[model samples]
Target: MQSFFKTNWIHSLWLILLFAGSLVGETVTPKDRLIVETLIRLNRFDVSGNEKWKGAVQRYARSQRGEEGYFELVEQFSVEAELPELLRLVEEDPTSALSAKSVQLIFRLGEQKKLSRLLSGSPKKKANAIITLIGFVKTPEAQKLLDEHKALSAPATSVAKGAPALISTADDIKALAARTGNVKQGKVVFQKFCFACHKAGDLGLDFGPGLSEIGSKLPKSELLLAIVKPNAGISFDYEGWTVETKQGSFLAGIVSESDEELTVRMVGGVSQKVKKADIAKRTKMKASLMPEGLHLAMSEMELVDLVEFLSSLRTR
Candidate 1:
């Protein structure tokens, strides 16, 4: 019968769509490529273990064009590397915006005294440094010094916390799923936190992976997990990689297109065309370029809302 043939054709079409979806189980998006490129640059610094890059970074920080990238480098290296020289470079020009942030970072780590000592020769030279120290120091000693010197202003010190550790269990994630989330509020949360790097519905930069159709690709639980712990799962072809050159320099970035010549996209959105003849060593990185604790900035309910918004993005 004609009705039976139409029903069979509809079933066949459904099967075809199911098969097509399976083929793209772990496909990469443009945002993934961007994050991989950023990871590449971070990994390059990890692999080389070179001190010379410090000077290069300092110079870049001082430069108007590359200062943003310089700060990102400093933040990543703050825990692993001793960067007294880089600190000195910024401190010497204390009034600059970058220097103020550097001073705040030093004080946060209880190392403002090191900055104070660097300015120690003359009382006149130390006045500006003292003012910075007094503004950022929380201790009684700083107040005593400020009182003794009769310093002009005493701004409140800033307290910073380290990134929150991931503590969500399977039960915790399941509980969150059961809770209701407001999609409209979730959109606001995404704008506040993820809009800068991630793309959704023609909004946001292309710098990170596009989440336009992420809901259909990943389950709600996996989506929640990815937001809290980004390094947990990385898409294929978006892994971090480092290339050591014969000239003793290192290149970091995601390999975009590889063949006779490998194309790597580096941090700050720079593309590197690498030739096989120039390569000394190539290593695949273990850690992901996508930093973790993305959900730390949001409240639990806000995160649930964000997850809800993402989950609603299923393709028809």
Candidate 2:
């Protein structure tokens, strides 16, 4: 009898501990692919929803609260009605992308009247927000604010300083790739630059599309084009998307697919789906999700090596 009672007591204690952990979010795992995928699919970019969507949002928000997904939820949910919440978060965490996205939504929602008030906040906070603003708003007022704060921002770490500049043009780079390609050295270069967003063989994450079989697919010229000017041919499923909703929220991602439902996949590999009726406006973006000027960071030989490495990715 005592053994059975002790077993029940241990089981009850274990359950209580798990319940407590769930309440504080200690049970939340960042690498939980199912939860992450669910968060992505349910996000319609519009938080103003019916009971069903609202419950999903609230449930996930509670589970993922205080995680990065929480900030993402706050950012996705930012609308005209939520400006006060956005502003408070921006003021508290100006250096965060969450705050930057909030600021972008404010401008897109035609709430420029509030900009001056944000500018009047603490000089450092205002400056941080302005750094994100100048890129979106090109007006003289915005430019002037940027000029004042630009010097305060830290410069990006240089990938390549003053070095021997042999060639940068696409034709020349391709020719270089044909001549002196070193797969091993190229792998090193890729690990340094592209590995974070790309998966090559067993290396790196799947944030961007996997390149394990890229060489088998794309010809040499096409590969060169992808390297030099990524925007020249945005992949069909990977095309960029900028979404705005009637609630005043803004979202940017790659629109993966939309039939009865729409799916937007973010750069971090999180995908969200929304009903077709919920999206206020969706635009195909003009730019590649990959940033330009990556070649500028590499030595001429480094570029050749990287291309050669990618080109070697043929059949198994």
Candidate 3:
């Protein structure tokens, strides 16, 4: 068995060389093929061997592959094993495709524990990471984290401001609710922030639940709580699924079929048609695709505006 294993390993290397040679005469470059194979191998190891293979992948990524090449490299290396390193690389050279790839990877990983750690580390990366995670991992833990860290008021307030910085008083909620924020102002704020992950009237990111009927399903207080502290009472229907194949490829999407063929709608709106026979393991993420504390970027007024808009949504 040992001899056979050695023979197969040698054969695999020979095959890789032969394939590389075949590509030499074609438009595909050696670097491109190397990167592709590295991706294939990385997918096979369960997030463990990533460190061994990441250097080669990063080197190839640095080459001037242009937009398409950068995108491909990002997609390939966005796995869990490569995510931390990718995040560091993005910090050093924010323009590198690796930075965006880090965001994309966080979205796909859909792990709130990991995301929360990242958010607690860097405010800027945390903000962007939270936004991306919001579209993927919406859970009570996420919501709770956001609620705890939420900046309810401006950094500072003055006597001329006519109100305390943080409104913890019961009378404040009543006053704020009675104030009736401008719907037009709310629309602008929604378009700028919430619209990217939520849809009300045929607009916003398709990844999140539609808010067209939120008012009918949930009350104003509930809506406010969801925005302020999102992770509470998270509905499981919103959690996404991740599948790992025996061949080392990871796929995530909403599970469309479960019998013999496990169909999943992958990120970027692609469908992963996989056979159950090919699946090695499957994990249902506990977190919601929506990140916690999405409203951190918004001001108190903006949160009020968003709440007003959401409270207006109804099926009828």
Candidate 4:
């Protein structure tokens, strides 16, 4: 009787384990729903001309939109119903967040003619839009417009005091045309000053984003800003900080870490590692470790060359 009872209990436990495994298998999480729902909604919109699915798109865009998915939708949709509305919104209220998003969409669509018309109509909106779009499209037409605007008016100095001074000239046009960066010289400068924080190809520190294609993604002015005033909140990322510990061991640098280790690249080009365990606490310093006078460190022509070098680094 005792032996039979033990066998039955063991069988019951096995059944419970099986049931738990099945339950785990049957339950669907957000990750599972995200791909299927996103794809299904994308396909549904692609097949039908209905704007009904736009709510889903907006939700996705607002919540957790992937770059691939966003660009895919942009590529697939030709109707462009939202764009006209966005453009109208911008015209009515240029400073609206909706207008800014609309301008971004226009640039993403690569509708240069429409963008040009919008710019012609509204100078302030055009200035902001142009600055944003310069990161994406570096076409000759865009360059010409930027040149024309700069010629007519001074480039706005950022509110940040002592912003890196930009010298705008017709010569800028020539530099833009030549696309000249002494890569050999740039490689040396990059290694000496930039490599401690930034990484390119297989070399340099990975504390900063890879610069293999930075030249292609950013304009000369923006790149210069990144070097000089790195803490201007340009994007969701790249804000530099320094951290201090209660133990009186303060580290001034950007925090680059992974699951295993926390790495800090100090302001004066020293890289240090603190074990994840030893860190009692950390605080963020407001300024960027990217030196303020880096532009001054290089000659004007060299700076232009470096800009030329960085501008040419495009992946696509």
User: Residue 142 deviation, candidate 3, in Å?
Assistant: 17
TM-score of each: 0.46, 0.55, 0.47, 0.38
lDDT of 2 at 215: 85
What's the true lDDT of residue 20 in model 2?
A: 75
Worst window of 10 by summed lDDT in candidate 3: 155-164
On residues 206-287, what C-alpha lDDT tens digit does candidate 4 reach at each position? 5556798897777776776676556664344555554444454444445678896677653222345666676767666455
Candidate 2 regions exceeding 4 Å error are: 1-13, 16-151, 154-159, 162-171, 219-222, 257-260
Ranking by TM-score: 2, 3, 1, 4
Candidate lDDT scores, in order, read 0.57, 0.60, 0.56, 0.52
Each prediction's RMSD over C-alphas, in Å, is: 20.6, 8.5, 12.7, 21.1
Winner of 1 and 4 under TM-score:
1
The TM-score of candidate 4 is 0.38
Q: Model 2: what TM-score? A: 0.55
For model 1, the superposed segments whose C-alpha errors exceed 4 Å read: 1-165, 247-249, 267-269
Task: Sort the candidates on lDDT, descending order.
Answer: 2, 1, 3, 4
Question: Please, what are the lDDT tens digits per residue for candidate 2 over residues 266-285?
Answer: 54344456667778988887
Lowest-scoring 10 consecutive residues by lDDT in candidate 4? 156-165
